[model samples]
Target: MSVSTPSSRPSASSSASPSVADLVAATPADRNRVVDLLRGAAILVVCLGHWLMAGVHVDGAGELRRTGLLGIATWTHPLTWVLQVMPVFFLVGGYANAISWRGARARGTTYGGWLRARLRRLTIPLLPLMLFWAAVAPLASALGVDGGTLRIASMASLVPTWFLAVYLLVVALTPLTLALWERCGWWSVLGGAAVAGLVDLVSVGGDLLAVGFCNYLFVWGTVHQLGYAWRDGALPGAAHRLGLAAVGLVGLLLLVGVGPYGVSMVGVGGHGVDNSYPARVTLLFLGLLQAGVVTALEPALARFAARPRVWAATVLVNARIMTVYLWHLTALGIVVGLSLALGGVGLHLQPGTGTWWATRPLWFAVLAATTALLVTLLGRLEQPAPDPRPAPPAVLPVAALLATCAGLAVMADLGIADADGTVNAWLPWVPLVAAVALGTVRLPAVRRRGDRSAPGGYLAP
Candidate 1:
């Protein structure tokens, strides 16, 4: 959830960007290169996992269709144990946010200023994505795309938005949560996990489906809390890490093996009780297990990430992590759409067939190329613009945060298009709310004396 930029050594010529070697050399000595590598790795894994799981084909009726491979190949459910990397993502977010918040506090930055900066970094990248889908939904609908196809495309392309919605909520609560961490240390994490367990019990046992949504906060919040422990070095030594792993493994076994939760960490259609959709206690356990495993390997990971070539690649990828994440699925959709338009060329091969598996390399090559193109064109938008103005009244950012979260949550659920592909009723408000969030702390542009350009301009915060 934290978007980080790599530090660049100043070039001999100011206009020239720093080379990869320069970036690696300029890395702060104390910076945890392993965290950066893990974040980049997690994003790549999520993209690959999604691409691999997608089962797209042109039906016998000549209509495009999509299905989840996990749903078709039930045995693949356990594979999600490795593929579902959201826990790592949240853990890194907590680590990064704690450092950011602490630094901002030390620098005399007010809560409003700090919050606004974080919100801008998070929300600005979303505008272009929202705009593209907003324009495409209605037009595609008019061009005779069926509701089912459009829905599939919308859902796939907007997957990142759903994650953003939940992550933004967690981030907005960081001040309070981090404070709890400081005051109570490990208890904060336990309290969050306990609350998540309680929510699961109430929702599943009492059968009140609406209450389960609370786990979105409790479960991820607990994982995020773990990141704070990681940053503070509270989880030290092999014993601590291995103990966490054991407890998590036991919890997952109990929850999924002996309890009612499904084994799949990612949603598999028609699978009873998805552990991911509402984020059951199973996910918290999975997060703990993954966290323990990854942190235990930190010494080795740090050594690997310290290599000049590897660290440079990590820095480059981390620089555009948000853009890459937001658009990778869209790139997949485009690749699938192209295949469908071309008489289903490579996609006609049945899922799980020998030929289908054989062509994965070609399929992934096309996806990687398409995703690279998207990142080249759209990645700059993810960079935060320089804004020297003072933070606005706290109310402005507070309102903006609420509005932004609401808009994204609605979009994640209903999507920009309804079943028939027309723009959803909530679509119009998405951009408007985004504008408000981006504009909350932005000041009117001022031109220097003798400047002939426009006197005022708008910039993303």
Candidate 2:
């Protein structure tokens, strides 16, 4: 969701890393610092929210048990209104893509070339993660970890892949969506929302859970389209922003208060009716509310982000946001594993109790330290060396994209291992192969004037 500028790339030499001042000075005058700030803030909130909601303890038989605080404490359901910030990320994605695609078109970049560049950045970092889990699953089973515990740990660690799967699809369709936006304008957003509403109604009325998955496109895509509105100055005044907020609030109240959807924005297992997962019309409303509120405050936020120090920090975080998002939960898994190994020494306190609340600072400190260490070790993979290979035939990138999404979807559903801790046969190979195909595909060799084969020839640019 962090749609970064080309300059967000890491320094060429780690030993000569740029200082905060240097980074701030090099920023383009036309850059939108507010979007970067929002993206960074959203990812951090997601990480902290996940850490806060995770409930782990040792059972009577000394086995590690995992639960969710939201499921235990019903009173906290309303808090998801604030914590569910994914809409902001999608909205930002829309704005960034609108700008990126427009510029690419201006420069006469072909669709295949542009898509290949984006896919490389998105899929390359995933290979190491797939490999790490492939090794960990079998090793944990051999060490005698119980199936339930291993499955829970594995799913929690890989949960971020679900987001990647969906976002990658959204990104792949950007060119088409942007064209629709240019032609249809606000109707595009309205049509998307209308379809999403109908899908929810059908799913709820007919008890068709499978039909609900279509909202993955309608809901998020609508929000993404609203981002197009934002970029084009369609929602320009405080009045328009306030009106959006009002409409969203009213819709939310009617849906949750007078209708069937649950109050929690996040999916809590056993809650029966989840507003997430497939996503519901309720999320579209929440997104509208968030979009309205944040855009209304953008003037003030932009001023705040203009400060050199604040902008520098935002830039640094945006540069590695994907890595942080991917690995934060893995850090949590590691901490929980260590605690279990030590006989639940620090995790023994009952969740939602005074003692547990008092220890959260230390708990966060440990998790953050672990996550930082992992990021330090693996962050370099986020910035791969430039792909010198020529772009392949247009069909290859599309095929590669589909394979990557399919692999990620499988991982999201099944995790790296089953409940008995046996690794999924597709664990590493599917995505690993997809990544290789994406990065290594090239045009057939062409003969040069000197009668030598030329290995580098782009499809179009």
Candidate 3:
């Protein structure tokens, strides 16, 4: 495929106008809608997978697998083909990064400054939730709660955070990655795919690179380059789109059916290592297929997304996408914790027999209800600051992102320090607490740009 170089001149719409959000807002509807639809799809899939995998309990008396909501963990492996949407997540991410980077360059914002601003939204709210859980786990243990249960809950809460780390790496390298895209064109993406495949082959027993997580570079990096493709219309026209989809689907099918890779996409622990664990080449194929399918249908999707109600809802959610993504896991945890505290939550899983199929409807209702409560209480994070006015360039929200990531990293690294006998386990949580405190105080500076009446005034939601 041929790649069109990024134009140095401002895009047609930008040539006559000057505004940050406006420029971002004015990005072609086709690209914007693609990001929204992909995000919506990714979140939905994640929720589905979580519903199947959270709060699974085993029977104490019977060797048979008793049931919990997470009981499906035993057999949900096959659903990965239908349920895993990681590829799309990265694809949309690439698009967002490309747009943001382009806009930042146009506005003369430094790369570091532009990134810190975007990263703040992604990292801020995570601070409070992480601290709340860190405190809760220790408190519950002290109060005689089952240690195993508390550990499980903590592990589940940290599941989605892997993406945060990988995404940060991608964001931090935006300048270099974009430069590669510009220099090598489509070949850069192909090279990424090749690198991922090579890593998977050499890793063999999952010893190297932590179950192919290293491919976060190659697989995700490849999909991200396609965002550049989307921007340039390099994959334009119906015929080209269809051809790309066909090739991607055919390649993906071969991988699952006869290639060395396994068919499952969610994850299989103790299998030595898993491709899905870190997102490998198989997911790269999915990204290509998803992007092609979305691009081919962009015109139609744009028309549909333009309806007043539909567009309004998208705008509202887009405003809060970070909140929803970060908090959905918290939502499930609340339900699980509540259920456990209330004495018992009925979950009967026959395991391999798949007898729980009928109960799925009820389980889904419980999860939905739990999510609603979580959203209502924590959704405040989704709201724009009362003042829609964007902070000045220098004041953009880097502190929040840097503060939160550092905190989480420190928290995660505590065991290392303790193993070396150099630091206390509890010391790590201190950074986490400090990060959240700083973020809460700094978030107001991250609002959108608009006219302001008073120095610290906010616009009403």
Candidate 4:
């Protein structure tokens, strides 16, 4: 790994809760600034991307209908290419997981324990967001909101939550995946790619929708494996990174230009095939293309992030990542609701019109400000919970994580409510995930103490 370990940085709530400035100051000098830079930029791009693209209008009876710029303006494909950042997040996550897991194992942590600690952080932040949605459904339904819009808005708001489900599955399988990487090296990635191609072929040729879903593993799993390569210096040199970027660019162009792939990185729902969903080869190309872009930009971004002011901003953004993501859709909803109530001129126009273009800057500014406020108000919930005074039982962490994943997967399909839009489906996940996250102790830390004599820190080369 290029990154050298530094002294432990304090938590956001070490003494009193950290201010954004304090959080920035607390970052260790030896940590990977470039990774954090990429993270910060990616999060903002995602937030603003949705806000800028979202076109909401009232139905005749008055409920917000969501639309996107890609459907409206065919010229927006290049922009989607620039902003689709999920691949970068997964790659960085792979790298980060490699480092952290090695660190934990060095101190002799068990796979189960390490898995528990990892999944807890991911799941805890979700409860509040889901709970808020759960609470709102009945009230909104009672107020006579259009059933279709209510359903669409609720599901749309939680769209980002699918990443958590996917990520948790990845993290849960990390020990196994890492082991596969150890034994097979880059062959694992190649295998995944092959599987992905086969999936596309089978799904497309056979007219089987279920088979396409397997791309989640074949595509992202391959990219995640690349993170292992990245951490171990297997992906060495600017030439390597640039070559990847170049090839990925060509591959993406071929997929979109020649293949049946949709041009947009994000899929507009209710369309026959949302490119982002159901895992297409196009997204795999996106991963390749974006990974190359990330590598190409890393050096410059690292240098820029080293600036004290820039670093501080990055820290602030990083601190509330899940919080920001969770709240961003709500921010859009609020802004759209307000704009409609006020009868804002720009928002009322067709999305691609010249007047809409002129009004975007102001609209963006308004959305950003509103999102910041929402983050400020709820972001703290995402901060790591105070070190548990008395840790919970060591057993069942993985099981809990699985239940959580299942719940989230279900939620992704059904939204906060069932297909009928009843919040009753909130079972097994909301309560189950909450109980595990809150009730569980610090699994890794607790495990590390008992087995300090082992010599198993970093994974074998």
The candidate scoring highest on TM-score is 1
Clashes of each: 0, 0, 8, 1
Where in model 2 is the C-alpha error above 4 Å?
1-22, 270-272, 440-461
Could you give me the TM-score of model 2 versus the true structure? 0.90
Candidate 4 local lDDT, 240-259, one digit each (tens): 87787787789888877777
TM-score of each: 0.91, 0.90, 0.76, 0.86
Candidate with better TM-score, 1 vs 2: 1
Instruction: Report the poorest 10 consecutive residues by lDDT, candidate 3.
Output: 452-461
Model 4 residue 92 CA deviation in Å? 0.7
Displacement of the residue 370 alpha carbon in candidate 3, Å: 2.3
User: Distance from true position, residue 389, model 2, in Å?
Assistant: 3.2
Writing each residue's lDDT as its tens digit, candidate 3 over 219-238 gives: 87788888777766688798
> Which order, best to worst by lDDT?
1, 2, 4, 3
lDDT of 4 at 406: 68
Q: Which 10-residue span in candidate 2 carries the lowest summed lDDT? A: 452-461
How would you encode candidate 2's per-residue C-alpha lDDT over 1-461 as one tens digit per residue?
Answer: 22334464334453233433445555667777788889988998999888888887776788777768898888889899889998998998898888878878887877777788777677767777888887887788788878788888888888888888888888878999999999999889888889999999999889999999888888988888878888888899989988898888899999999898889999886664789977999999999999999999989999999987788788667656777888899899999889888887887777888888899889889988998888788765554445555656657677778887887777777777776567674665777787665553222243223211111111001
